[model samples]
Target: MSVQPDLFDRSLFRIRRHRALKAAKPGADFLLRAVAVDLEERLLLINRTFGTAVDLGGHTGLVTQAIVNAGKAGRVLRADLQVADPNLPLPDLVCDDALLPLGDQSVDLIVSALTLQFVNDLPGTLIQIRRALAPDGFFLATLPGAGTLTELRDSLTRAELEIRGGAAARVLPFADTRDLGSLLQRAGFALPVTDLDTITVRYDTMFALLNDLRAMGATSILKDRSRTPISRRVLFRAAELYAENHSDPDGRIRATFALVTLSGWAPHESQQKPLRPGSAKASLAEALGAKEQKL
Candidate 1:
């Protein structure tokens, strides 16, 4: 099979994150914390405790701490690209998401927070994650989905087109729910599921939103992006377009974040499976007390 071209610059992604640490604001991790809360709630619903858990791409250990705080896992370890801050909690294993160092069936759980979208080979990474899980082990992750940052993408493309008569990909692509669920199944997970939650964050201006994106280490790092720097004229025009098009009644502009959550389990004989075709436990019409209509 042909290989897909690398879309993201992983090195640049790491560098941007390290730079964000130096100038990290108090609320720079707002998105991470939001995902963490939802993840924690999901964990609470699962009854059993994990013997060991690895928090993949868990920068600063916020999700790691959340996993611990949820009282779900007996022991938790963290992995990331680098240690951006000495004062903050560092990763237990510093490595790429696509190349996990853990052995086969070594971990009872793996949780990734807002990281997979940057990976160049997401399907391969999912397969690696599946291999890392113990039999019946759980895998949970949260990342920005296809609809995240619609306003910024629209504004930037329109502004660049209007100013320079052309546009480049200023936004990174994100996976949709259906594709991710299929990936999990392809990775050999027993019961793969994907869902999303959308939230809008309002900002006073586009510049402020851009600043926040930088602080969050979420700026575009597409490898094929144009080398020419964005001119101030184009930048200002983009901001104006953002304001004019996406602003709320109170004057603040809206930025949408669609957080997709993925969950699955390693295959095991004990797990539930779909029945064979034409082997029904009961007739659907009979269950509803209605006669079946022949096709």
Candidate 2:
């Protein structure tokens, strides 16, 4: 069998996360906090409380804190690339999302925020997550989806092509909602659902958007990334292109983040199941109370 090559550099991702943690400033975790609030609302909708919950790849423990504050979990343990921010809360396990050490059927709930987009083997990781979840357990995760950084991606690609007559993959490709839904089913989850949440953030300049990505530890870590440093000419040109193409009337640039949410439950007898083909008692025409029309 042929082996699949890794698409992302895990070591570089960890190093970048460490740097982001060290240089983090106020509002750097704005996305995480926002997602945490969203997750809390989701958990609130569920009536059952979790016996053991895990904040998988929780960088600053914001999701973990949210789980605690929701009062829906009996115990919450955090995990990440490292203890990115010890000042906030330490992780019970330091591990990559691809490599989970948690035992099979151990956790009742698992919530990951702002992670999984960088995982080299997302399908395998999802399978592992499925294995770790107890029967009828719940899983919720939010990550940057297909159209996360369209403005930056277009600007950078254009600028690089103009300067060097060529361009590499600067922005990592994000997961598609359809593909994620399929993956959830492939991983043996029941009642799988995936949806996109688009958020537009305005920045004074393109550089400001770049800095925000850096602060969020979301910079490129592609395996085939260029080793050469981005020159000033390219950076400035990219900024100019960005302003020209994606700017508000007030001259602020627009950056789009399409956050994708995936939610599912481990298979169990109690959970709802779809009816088998040809098993439905009522036909579509009968349900609609109209005769079926043939084309």
Candidate 3:
């Protein structure tokens, strides 16, 4: 089936992501590492070893490293949009996020980290991931959910409206927590589950947050974004608004990052299935000791 129109400038995202990788410091990927840590914890809970795995969008190979360190996967391949910097030790499989280069049922595990939110066709990508997994294989990922950058979004919107009379899309849209589970099911994943973790980061100024976003390759790449760079006047105003509305008692501005963690398995007859209708021996009314009433 066809998917939504391009919401993001995928080419631009790749260019920026490459620049971010080139200019990144040794520990600049702290956020990616944090997500990888959580991914490791989730894998530990499952206690299943994967024979072959793909680390989709494995920025800096942190997720790959986490999986390897945890001994979760026997062999892991890294796939990303750009070749890693030679200075950094990483795999060299450069590929698009939406079009994974893997055969059906080829991989036993797929782990994506903070990557799906940038794809223009997320549903299609998820379906592709599902198709690439072996039966009963696992797909685990974390993407920024709704409310990820509420402070920045609000500040930019208010600043633009007051200064330019209107605002163009300045922030990337994120997946909603409510819709993710259903999306997983639609993508033909079994035992679909989704949960969220909200990380509140404090920045001394709006510029600080923007700097971090740029370094993380998380800057706005909306297809319909303004061609011109943001003006200094609007930017300053946004900083003022952000501080006024989102500052804590200590005067540091709070930025909310809601990470939506998703887990699903490729369908297999061996996996648990829901009970059929009328399969239960006891009625809810009988179990709860309440009278049954006819509607």
Clashes (N, CA, C under 3 Å) per candidate: 0, 0, 0
- Candidate 1 ranges with C-alpha deviation above 4 Å: 288-295
User: CA shift at 262, candidate 3, in angstroms?
Assistant: 0.8
Can you give the lDDT of residue 279 in candidate 2? Answer: 100
Kindly list the per-residue Cα lDDT of model 3 for residues 67-158, writing each as its tens digit. Answer: 88778889998776655644456564878878888899999999999989888877888999999999999999999999999889999999
Off by over 4 Å in 2: 284-295
Pitting candidate 1 against candidate 3, the one with the higher lDDT is 1
Query: Which lDDT value does model 3 have at 9?
Result: 87
Candidate 3: C-alpha RMSD after superposition: 1.8
How far out, in Å, is residue 109 in model 1?
Answer: 0.6
- Candidates in order have lDDT scores of 0.90, 0.90, 0.88
The alpha-carbon deviation from the true structure for residue 18 of candidate 1, after best TM-score superposition, in angstroms, is 1.1
TM-score of each: 0.95, 0.95, 0.95
- How far does residue 123 in candidate 1 sit from its true spot (Å)? 0.3
TM-score of 3: 0.95
CA displacement after TM-score superposition, residue 80 of candidate 1 (Å): 2.2
Evaluated at residue 264, the lDDT of candidate 2 is: 94
